[model samples]
Target: MKKLIEVDHVSNERVSNVHFSLMEGSLTTIIGPSGAGKSSLLLLLNRLEDPDKGEIHFKGKKISDFPISELRRNIGMVFQQAHLFDGTVEENLKFGPSLRKKWEQNDGVKLLEKVQLSEEFLTKEVENLSGGEQQRVAFARTLANNPEVLLLDEVTSALDMRTVELMEELLHKLVKEEGKTILMITHDLKQAKRLGSYTLFMNEGKVEEQGETASLFQHPKTAALKHFFEG
Candidate 1:
């Protein structure tokens, strides 16, 4: 397909000169050590934090050229924590679209079902749910926009393995069938390999190496890769 996101020498003072290109209709994993700027790079796509000197383009249009509302709606982001407001689950889902965020209840619920959550949870209070449930709700909320590009920041890092599996299955579907572009930051290489077809192995805020998931993990290119897998 086309290039959905083009990040060239993307450097915010907080981050480093990270260079990468995420293709359209594909799932690309951003893996690296702590403070490697995986999450920072995710934020840059929507200009959550501007790059000191670099350019980001989405669908051949400069990200800087997009209006805030238009840009955010097209690029949905899920943070490390499940940040649900103190309200019923449905309210949280509704809130995003109600505020003119790009979303459709029908399509969003389909995505939610993949995450293994029922529509019944919609009426339940968000705060009462467990961590896994909260993350599921968060996933539904993120899909509220039906974004072309989904930015996931270690979304399952806090959940247990079972919860992680559910989230992984949902993400896998998004990448494979839904044809949505995804840029995910992950600490777990197992999760990365399972969910991402492409991989960008980063270290100290730069891409040390990148390739297909199986090849990169099976015959890792750098010493950093060796240390990362060993540790």
Candidate 2:
């Protein structure tokens, strides 16, 4: 697996001295308490915010070298809340691609199906959907741009257990079948262990531990990580 994203000595107001690499076709989970810079990291990755110090490289090139539009299109992000516009699902799905002039008539249905939504969802108003449905729509909307990576921020935190489980399944399918590289922030320890091939443990805006999920969970090398798991 080639390195898809490399964060080298990155620092910002919320995080400090951070470094990590995400492999292509991998699903890596970032887990920690509030103020751990988990969300901050994602912001930098897609250039929603740039790091005050250090650099982020994607696919062996400096991220800053790419046009902002192309950078964001390839590194799509979905926030904790579904930030959809007041429109039908098809319209929302078409929003990104249409802005880039890449929209095709069949794009809405294809994007919906990728996120496990049916073709019928294309015509439905987004406001009429449930929370879980809306989140899936948001995911599908991001997919409309055909990003190489997906950054997820506690996307299932507000959902029911069953819906969370189903969302987890969808994420797995995205990585395993659709070949997306994902970096997810999750408050659920069990979900992190279940979904992430690799896990990054952060504390005080720094990466305290990172490794294969099974090893990181079973043999935490730092006291903060051990306490995190214990508590």
Candidate 3:
């Protein structure tokens, strides 16, 4: 598979000398203890926060070479908390595409369906939706931009177990059908194990171990990783 994004010795206030490559159409989970820089690493991917040093390349070109808006649109981000505009769900879904003048007549309904929301949701107010619904709307809104890569920062953390499971299912469908490259951050080891095709285990701002999910979990090579699974 092609490498969609490459992180080369990236560093920031909270992250240090981190390195990894996101494979196209792959789901990679970033896991570690609190203050391990998972969120910081994600911010660098979408340019929400720039690294103090090192470079990030997208599709063999430097990320800095791409226009910020273009780069961000192609690499969308969904945070733990869904931030919706004070408007109808359809309006929120239209926000990103409208900015780029790429709005389609059926985009709102199509995206809603993609996120498992019905057409009727188009008329509902975002604030009136439940947490799970809001998160789904957020995902749909990001999808409207037609991003190739999705940087998910603990997107399921605030959701209930059922909601989280639904979100995971939706994500799997997206990977299988839409071919989205997802880089997710999670504190839940079980969720990571279940969803991640590849896993990166970090500590003290550095990646300590990384490999296929089953291999890393079943045969950790580092002492830190062994203790993490054992404990």
Structural similarity to truth (TM-score) of each candidate = 0.93, 0.97, 0.96
Please, what are the lDDT tens digits per residue for candidate 2 over residues 1-231?
Answer: 999999999999999999999999999999998889999999999999999999999999999999999999999999999999998999999999999798999888788876678899999999999998999899888988989999999999988888787789988888999899999999999999999999999999999899999999999999999989898
Worst 10 residues of 3 by lDDT: 222-231
* Candidate 1 per-residue lDDT over residues 101-139, each given as its tens digit: 545657545655767887677778988999889988887
Q: What is the lDDT of residue 70 in candidate 1?
A: 74
TM-score: which is higher, 2 or 3? 2
Which one wins by lDDT: 1 or 3? 3
Clashing pairs in 3: none
In the range 1-231, model 3's lDDT, one tens digit per residue, is 899999999998998999899999999999888888888888899998999999999999999999999999999999878998999999999999999788988989899887788999999999899998999999889989999999998999988888888889988987878899999999889999999999999988999899999899889999988877776
Total colliding residue pairs, candidate 2:
0
lDDT, residue 225, candidate 3: 81
In the order shown, what is each candidate's alpha-carbon RMSD? 1.9, 1.1, 1.2
- From the highest lDDT down, the ranking of the candidates is 2, 3, 1
* Native RMSD of candidate 1 (Å): 1.9
Instruction: Give the C-alpha lDDT of model 2.
Output: 0.93
Against the reference, the lDDT scores of all candidates come to: 0.83, 0.93, 0.91
Q: Whose TM-score is greatest here?
A: 2
